[model samples]
Target: MSIQYVGLKEIKGSLIILEGVTDVAFEEIVEITLEHGEKRVGRVIQITGDVAIVQIFEGTVGLSGSNTKTLFTGHPLEMPLSKEVLGRTFDGKGRPIDGLGEILAEKKIDINGSPLNPVTRKYPRNFIQTGISAIDGLTTLIRGQKLPVFSGNGLPHDQLAVQIVQQAKIAEGKGIENFAVVFAAMGVKNDVADYFRRSFEESGVIQKVAMFLNLANDPVAERIVTPRCALTTAEYLAFEHNMHVLVILTDMTSYCEALREISSSKGEIPSRKGFPGYTYSDLASLYERAGMLKDREGSITQIPILTMPNDDITHPIPDLTGYITEGQVVLSRELHQKGVYPPIIVLPSLSRLMKDGIGKGYTREDHPSVANQLFAAYAHVQEVKALASVIGEDELSDIDKKYMTFGHAFEKEFVSQGRNENRDIDGTLDLGWSLLGILPREELDRIAPELLDEYYKPYKKKGSDA
Candidate 1:
């Protein structure tokens, strides 16, 4: 039996420091008893020469030395793994907040599980259609890759994340038949948290989703452990249960803040802006864990979402994340102010693994051709706008005039969709063709003859109103 110590050390704000403690691991949960016989819970966060710092899960109040007892379970925080975890609301540590008792789980997993060995990882080669033309047709999401949505202050990162999760689905003929999403929110506000809850319920995706939330009001140390705990659960689902899992983590900036705060508390030498020097390596350790395992039936795809501080991409958080992740979907604050719901600035957004995901068997054979044409047309449109600023629009060449028309038409027809619109591949491709119809076939250098024959819009005669 574990001995219960009656010596509760000094209460420094929200933390309780105890001396003469032994055998306590970082993040190990402990049961705390107050003098009034009320019980609470906490975790051992720091170990310093027999001095153990325990952070209370609930705020530490009315607990003093010589009147409290601390018992260590000799175990770190953990979560239950099972299919029943879906559609349930849990705390940052995977404990059910919906009035449910402890889950009779098959396995007890540590939150800080070891990273996936890179040598055993398979190269990712496939597509996951979000059913949104702006994403699939423009910035295609490749299966088994880590693609983050890079946003700035006042951007619609949350809304875009919701749309992606709501519409994301495995390709029609891929090996994976069913997929599930494990979404974890760290340091998010209550309203933003509610939006996700309502969105998942409305889309009926709750049944296939496992959600863990650490709100802004939660303890700072818990915020630090939130992502690791969520990722641990995802690893269990994807690796152990052989399921296709998409793990979405939002507001990573908040996680970094918590890291800096803890590092400051520990009195570690600071890197950039009081961040630990190993911040890059630490972030890589998390993002790199997502990928396709060789010869395994399951794969882990990560869509981590983080907004840049002050819209500065050079911020350490996004800069480090950029280095670790595959590609980025950059959101535009200007576009958000323009009343675009998603506000994804297409020019800067890209999916590096687009080639592997789109082709004859997976998507339409003309997928790449259409994407190239759209990109070229959009670039020309930008050029036209810039030239129109210098020289008058009335003096522009006929080709430039048509390019301007195509750009506006592309944004209105292809990019903008209803709030709940989930377009299929064929529908998205058809929209591309319709937008290309604005340009004459002679000017379509991006498309090949075969693609032209396959998806060409009927040509219009000269001087005919199209």
Candidate 2:
């Protein structure tokens, strides 16, 4: 017993107000039929007394208050799910755009997702190696963790992301299974969108990727739905099919801007930087969905990439994101200008969960110590460079000159790699040890004496022999 109401009380931007509506709920879907029988979709966003305010997904360019008919569908937005969703592309609204036709849905799931209880959450461990030395050897991305890449406008974050997709894999002997990637891009230009598709296809990882793209010209409402739809698909694959899923959400800054626009249209009170006060909770609703369930064999890892406005990390988007996610991979303009491919400033970038995930049985016995030494050595590099700027390099001590040499070689050999180069964890660790060989053994205070005797001494001996 559904009811259709002809005519409306008011039309405001993308919203239409209905008077005397009963039994309607918030977030419920609504159908808008125009005078000539053209149809549009909307959802109930706000309710007051017996009146409902609906925001149309498609804009209300041709609608009038009296000529349109509104009907409540009594259900929230949902996505059609099947394992076939992989290797396919869909619009932000969960409609297929790959010309592959609609999915034969095993089930239609609410895009809002099922609520996960905190008690059922399994602690994240075991790293997912991105194969980029800056990430793998330093800011390790742990499975079931939500780590973000904080980039800026002109950086090569897109290239870095594609490289990660092409090379990311679990450590050897962890499991025979390979994980699938769900890539969602919000408010990206058509050219950028095409690049993502073409890169994935050319790299041969497209078969395992599910892309949800909301182009720059698409409706703003779709930007809001894009990531939600992608996460829902990942949730189904991970929890039901028992597959490890890694979800990459790019340009979340656009999504937050879309939220701000919608909030302005609704006349809501604006909070910091014109963003709604509920931004934190709203983000939590999405980020908190990532993790492994205690009873499930699979996991969901999230790498949410957002560009800070004007490279300002304090902007509301990245600021709030830093508060929510585990840790951030901060891209460096300095390094990018210096010809570093990944451009990740390892000092500022870290994975808080790396301690539990790497070392011993997970990656390698020397991983933790090597990573710590890299950080310490890099930090000293910056200091020595600053000192050399004031007093000439000739005036610096021998140890300081050694640090400068180590720093240059570290960036050129370790951080910079070919785009297609895929290094295993062992290769990454060996390269790290080789770089440590440039510094004297006494400076490697982070490593145990035994580990230095094992990994560092061999590298120092090889350097001496050469």
Q: Report lDDT (CA) for all predictions.
A: 0.82, 0.90
In the range 392-425, model 2's lDDT, one tens digit per residue, is 9999999999899889988888888888898888
Question: What is candidate 1's lDDT per residue for 130-246, written digit by digit as tens?
Answer: 878888887888878999988887777787778877888887554444688888899999999999989998988888888889999987767867777778877887778777888
Off by over 4 Å in 1: 1-20, 37-40, 44-48, 59-68, 173-177, 458-466
TM-score of each: 0.90, 0.97
Q: After superposition, how far is residue 167 of candidate 2 from its true place, in Å?
A: 1.3
User: Residue 107 error for model 2, in Å?
Assistant: 0.7
Model 1: number of backbone collisions: 0
lDDT of 1: 0.82
> After best superposition, candidate 2 residue 179: deviation in angstroms?
1.4
lDDT of 2: 0.90
